[model samples]
Target: MSLRLRLNLLVAALNLGFLGALTWLLIDNHRNSIQEEIEAAHRVTVQMLGSAAQTSPVFGPAPVVMVNFLQSLGRVRANDIRLYTADGVLRYSSPPSAYKAGRTAPDWFGGLMRSTVEATVIGLPGARIEIVPDASRAVLDAWDSMTAIFLLGLGFVAMLHVALLLFLRRLLRPTEADARRLVATTQELAENREVMRLIEAGIEQERKRLARELHDELGQSVTAIRLIATSISRSSEAPGVTQGAGKVNEIAAGLYDSVHRIVRELRPAVLEQPDLAAALADLGREWRIRNPDIDLSMVLEGDLGDLGEELTLAVFRCVQEALTNVLKHAGATRVRLAVAQREDRLEAIIEDDGQGEPNALAGSGHGLVGMRERVATLGGSLETGMRPEGGFRVSIVLPLAGDSQ
Candidate 1:
């Protein structure tokens, strides 16, 4: 069964059971109380008659007194009572009579009145004869009234239970709807996360391709130009000729170095290695050599091991971008790059003691945008701001495999 239907039926059944039990108890109690009251009245009448028989003189001798007492007992307690003579003649009543004097009592009442009571008799050896009439119809009437009330109460209880079940079912509808909406939203977010990962992966591939073209094709051309200059120097022995060769060789060497540097910046060779810290350290060393006037420090605060390929690439790129920005914009003398596993998360911070402004390096270049996108894709966060001192700082945090959303 559906949950709502099952719950409704269960509630209804419990209520019905309780109502039935309560009704039975009430009806039984009412019937028993009325019967007890009637019995008590009959006992009082019997006792009063017996006492008058002992005291009254109009009753005459013992036999007459006994008969008078019996007659008076019949008169006082005969609400629907029946009587019979020694020869089984009908006698008296206390209410609307259903019997007449000429008629003998019915076969059932006559048989019951003729029966013997076996109580211990003080003078007689044999059991004494006694009479017992059927219970009063008034008792039957009271029982019927109680039964009617019980049935009515049962009907009311059933209706109330049904109403309660329906109301509870209606209340659950909104809660069920909210759960469904939450599930849908979570699924949508998961699907979007996958799409973003694919897009970022495509961008990485493109960057690698461009870097290869610059290194292989442009670097080769520069190498050929340098070799040609060396060959001219070897063959031309004249003073002016040698001077021209030396100058051409110097220019060619400079051009080759510059082209190689551009290629490396586009996509560093260290990224191809499996180790992330090594790649970052290589970038740091290169930056230090290129900017001899400024000081740079790189600290690996934890054991940098195999954090998956995508995450490693993203973190490396972020550090590369941050340092590049500092060198290009921040006129500070020192820069520090700190990478560590802080608590459960991997964190990287690039801080420089340079002229700092949060909006200073909001360049139109793809570098900063790519950095934000990469970190976001990993369920991470990146923030760039001015340090308390006169410097710039970039902080990035990415969760571990079990920790990431």
Candidate 2:
């Protein structure tokens, strides 16, 4: 249902409940007033009857004057009176009559009034005079007042509802404009996200292409030059020429190694498929060779074959950067590397027993910044701190990817 209709229904329900409560309270007050009036009249009637009997004992002596007097009062107008004999038989009563000049209320109205036998009896030992209170006129007056109040209240609530409903409609008019703007903004954001995805994919493809070209063309050319230099140095024994050719061969070998390293850095081979663990082990082995003094211990866990290329690359880059920092800045002897996967998350920790600054990449080092970004892209977290036990620690946590195999 529409909001407007729902609000209207709620208001209507609340008003109806209020009206019902008010009606009950009014009816209750009227009933209480009737009770008080009847009780008061009963007290007075009892006193009058007692006084009459004290003056002359009509019940005992069968006084003709008192009986005729009571009959005369009954004929004109009397409270609801009934005289019962000692044997439990009705002897006399007030004549049937209307409450007002010519109107008597219906049975429902009578039922709505207070009960009848709530009044008391007043008489001698052999006689019973039941004083049935007659408050029908008062009851009718109360009913009339309640009906007027209800009609007035209902009309007022109707006008109030109409005014408030109109006000709400006017107030909500600007919301439609905001809703349209929100929809447009959401669509723009989605389009931008798709564009970013395409750009990222293109960049990855370009890196792969470049790595292939460097490995195939430049790498092969450098290898041939090194081979020819090696052959010339081995055959020719002229001391000066042999020394020069050896130097040339050594420089060529260095260039080839540099090219190979650059190609691997540009596009990691292990990231093409899953096998992230294998890639990490290879990285550790390389680092061990480079930093022989720094005792490197690797603890790799979990099958990383489920991780996607992007996630694997990101994590691998983080590990690579961390190791570079350790080699460059941290003058430590022992470096520990750990990568583990448990359930839906992958975690890697690298700590070195070196005197490295905790805030090394606070406002410096593009490498560390790039690492942080890479992990963040996959909804992961990175933490760096200096351990109290005398070491610098780098921690990384990443969400594991779905099945990519």
Highest-scoring model, lDDT: 2
Q: What is the per-residue lDDT of model 2 for residues 150-255, given as tens digits with 9 covering 90 to 100?
A: 8988888888888888988888676878989988887875665456546656777898899999999999999998989988899999998789889999999999
Poorest lDDT segment (10 consecutive residues) of candidate 1: 120-129
The segments of candidate 2 whose C-alpha lies over 4 angstroms from its true place after superposition are 1-28, 47-80, 85-89, 93-128, 132-174, 274-277, 287-303, 306-405
Writing each residue's lDDT as its tens digit, candidate 1 over 1-405 gives: 988888878887888788778866765565566556656655655455445534644546543445545555454432333333345444433334353333443444333323122211111011111333333443444445655787787788878887887798677677877989989988887777778889877877887898889778988887887788888888989888778988988998898888888877777755576467888888888899989988888889775667767778888889988888887888989999999966678999999999898684376777677788778778898888899977999999998763344
Model 2 alpha-carbon miss at residue 402, Å: 7.9
Error of 2 at 6 (Å): 13
What clash pairs does model 1 have?
A: none
Candidate 1 clashes: the total is 0
Candidate 1 local distance difference test against the native: 0.69
